[model samples]
Target: MDDNADALDPTPTRGATRTRTALRRVPFTLGFLAVVFLLGLFTGGLWSRLDRRSWYPEIAYGWPPLTEGKFWTPVTGWVFGLTPGQYLCMAILFGASVAWAEWRLGTARTVLVCASGQLAGILVASVTVGLLAHTHLAWADRLAEVRDVGFTTAAISALAAVSATLRSPWRLRVRAALMAYVAITFLFESTFADLMHLIALAVWLPLGEKLFSRTEHGFWPRTRREVRMLAFTGLLVIAAASVAVYFFPGNSLLGPTGDERGSFWSTLLTVLVIAVVADQLRKGKRWAWWATIAYGVLHVTLTLILLGVAIGTDYATTGAVTVGTGLLWAGEVALLYGGRGAFRVPLRRKITEGALTGTEPGVAVRELLARYGGSTMSWMTTWPENKYWFPADGERYVAYQRHAGTVIALTDPVGPPDLLPDTIAAFTDRCEADGLVPCLFSTTAAVADIAGELGWRSAQIAEDTIVDLPALEFKGKAWQDIRSAINKATKEGIEFRLVELADEPFAVIAQVRAISEEWVGEKGLPEMGFTLGGVEEALDPAVRVGLAIDTKGIVHGVTSWLPVYGPGDEIRGWTLDVMRRRPDGFRPVIEFLIASSCQAFKEEGAEIVSLSGAPLARSTDTADTEPIDRLLEGLGAAMEPYYGFRSLHAFKAKFQPRHEPVFLCYRDEADLPRIGIALTKAYLPEVSAKDLIALGATGH
Candidate 1:
């Protein structure tokens, strides 16, 4: 009878199954919201302010209510809000935050956290107000008699606790935003609700890591990017607070305000100066960091003098605005001190630029590569964006880019293989002497091993797809796609040609540019740089270009191959770089071009054809991956929709190439954040904030 019933019902649909799972996961959140809604309806508080109601005093929690022996107010107050607007906000915020917490911590634990947080916020805030009420501070005395209702504090605490469980980037991002919100509101508004929020956040944000988190917790900024962002946000917050004081100047936690605020023109000038410093801080400028530190110290010193005078005379006329601004300045000073290492970029022209003649670095790097062959990616080191670092002997050089106070070496050093260790050591020593973090990105296993021997950590960041040309043939099921593409191209009258791009006719070059532009136009992001090249790189005479052209002389697709040098200045292989095709002209032209290029290179005695590694794309064997690896994987997933890097990686598998791992080697895991940002800057040098926001929206 059960089997007959199961057969009749069948399995639930995916959407239904997901809905059931979601409902099961957030039972406490749902129940709490439902109870609050019922209470609001019963008390007529859904459309009206509960505080104005006759029965509010009995249920509201605060110092005055607690002193009157209404201990149960803590329990009753959480379900009510002072105003109808607050009720709406409470429902939305509490539902979203608690639901997320329940999803992470489970229903039982989430209930415990929410309840504990709510009770603690109310009792702690009440005790604090009661203690400070007799201290003659106007702000405290005023708040002591105020009663508040709502569970917003619990939502904030729950979110703060969950923040400890997050990984890099998000962990830092959430904590920064939470801290900024609480700090800003408490200092400026100083309302009873604001005090509750500040108290809850202060309790949970630090202690919750021990109580709730399973991951390692450290308060320090992990990446250079985090440091710059935090510093920038701190400066901007100070600027914002100044604007608030000048424009609003309402009662605040520090004291009463209004009379002590400076002239409007002076406030505007201060804000403008802070705005400029904030932008410079975002760029990790040394001058900006020092200037901000000096400004903070000076402001705090002056405020302390004023505070001393007021305290001594018992006049108490310094105002809350000065005290609040002083606290923020002190905070900014501490933040800048903690992250001082990130702000080393000089105010003058970059030290790396034109260290030699303008073209000397690029020319010297290429000559060294020819003298002693490096990894497949070595040719990319000669790109114009790179700055070369030559040792004292000048026998070898490392091509690198300085960004975010870090020196990121590209590929392997160019020189004799025997001098690899010395080259690595020299580069490391130079970075240390220069007070820059050292990193080696997109390098081979040999370089990674050398870095590991020197106590550096290495993680696979990409896989170089290589097709061995000597044994290459299109046969069997694996080569079915390539063979079909070739046959289709033949029938379609698409001819393949290998030539120097610069040698092509003006019309042909223009078509290639148009085709490339069209492909880039579809992505809605700036063209990626770093190891990724474009038509300019293809224009090099040494770089070979393969084209798929129809009988009508229309270009269907184009591929650029960088020459991989062997010993004795011989070209042993070709590494694929730029790959672009006409969106409307060719369907399988890429496969046709790659297959034809392989055959052409094989005829020319090249040992292999490299399809090149896709950035952030990894193989299936993810065993024993580190935290940094997982972070990169998540980043890759987020970017997959916009760039299709993983899709491209998968597409290369059609050629049946063997995967060789390329690694990012660094001195410490803590540097991954800065390195990640530097890599992003290197890739999308032209990408704007608006472009990134648009990309993020598209990803969502």
Candidate 2:
């Protein structure tokens, strides 16, 4: 929109101010719902007639009887102060409080949070309240009044509490104390409504962070079932109103119809309908179509019967009439229409974009921003966030690309999906120190978190994967086979040497680069796990380089290894960062490099040699899932036609390496869990520390 708006992007949008951004529902739904419920009770007849001041004493002991069984006869009493009115009010308020929440948090999460907080509140209420009060609810009463199906209380609690990492070590002491307080208060008094708040915080923050943090599907606006449920409630209101007027003639409905004073019933029905409709509208539904169709049919019938009478009907006014609203309410389910916005994925595009402001621009999609500040033209040389931040020790990297403007670099996944503005700015500042082109790639969105504190292009893109050496296994049949392969390579005129940083890294790298470039030419361009920069480009202090030359001193290829079991770091998986063979002796050369890499890994005591993947190693399995077996099977099946019949598998299978399968689970894919991240090479370029961290954190 406006330039200033772009600058102020990190700030949260205030929902109550307008149509309500998904994130802004907290104040209105959480706080405003409480206010309205209280008013509804006061106005809706909780104290319909309190002329006898003595009746006021009923307030002090209300909570105890309600949670108890016998006092709530027919399961309807003991609702408010053991009155149907109170139950109706509780239902209304509770529904309102959670409807928006369910909409915001998604179905599963909203239910989980609410159910948990409700249970926590109930149990804490039971133990504490039971300890203090003599009255206890019979099993029947407990079942009816507080049936423990899902989290009604906990959902409310979660809605109230805003912290996502409730179990974070730093927040543990406080979280524990809060949980204890929730237990105590629910036991002693009915006043504490913050348990749900705490649960809300505990459950929602992480979920929200995760949902939005998904480098893929977060940030799009769309409605979910929760919204539709609220919308459907409107049609129920209309149906219920029609029935109330038809049957309860003299109760307080419209004009008297027949017999007794059923007219007052109409008044109550109208209120119910109004409450439901208002709730639905606020939940963001254009119930206009259903509302119009439904009302049109019912009104036409009513008009024919009242042809001789005078009656005024307003679409807006009639919606307030309530009748047998249950079926109508239930029918709200058919109102599932927000699919367009909810599931609409944007078409993929290059991540970098432009804004004249000094700040990094927002991305169109979460594509890995090759660590360059957006300026459409500078896409090629930009690195992803991690690479930009490779030298984590506050050193800036500068570069001057022949085509783009001055290149100053910073390292961070700085904007929207990440928001690491300050880190980005600080990183670009490094250019002054290193004297290079300044740019930043927020490997992690941390860069965007501090945007307010910096003024630079904070935004960056993500790359598929980055190769890292320093960034696992078991021996059995697999081990014996690998040993044999290594032996075979040794007999094949292959020579291996480990360079502990000082051992002439380039002498070996030059030979490897030549072979690698030649391989690149044959395989096409842009090696998946490597850059054109070669072995020297792959070296750093945290890494150890190794070279495998032929007996003639012509380095056939290169291999890197790492300490598998460091006292400080439990390193297990060793990556095959670079392996290129001379075209003339490619097969024997590959076999030698492969065997040598495994040998070096074993020498260093590595458990598994991570050969990235056959396809994209990404899969749809959670960390807790048992997928290694299935992954191995799939790899065997797919590679059978190609790599399996070729030298790649011949070499790999000889190692008898236990296949480690990876999966990718998208919120959209129905069978996502079944989708394997077949091979990292297919999905990602190379692995980086950030990818490793995300693997641990998000379990993607």
Judging by TM-score against the true structure, name the best candidate. 1
In model 1, where do residues sit more than 4 Å from their true spots? Answer: 1-22, 260-269, 308-315, 348-700
TM-score for all models, in order of appearance: 0.58, 0.26
Ten contiguous residues minimizing lDDT sum, candidate 2: 339-348
CA error at residue 634 for candidate 1, angstroms:
32
Model 1 over residues 554-660: C-alpha lDDT tens digits? 99999999999988798999999989998788799999999999999999999988999999998855556788888778777777876799999999999999999
Q: What lDDT tens digits, residue by residue, belong to model 2 across residues 157-195? A: 543532222211212223333443443333222232333
Count of clashing pairs, candidate 2: 117
- As a TM-score, model 1 comes out at 0.58
Q: How close is candidate 2 to the true structure, as a TM-score?
A: 0.26
Candidates in order have lDDT scores of 0.83, 0.38
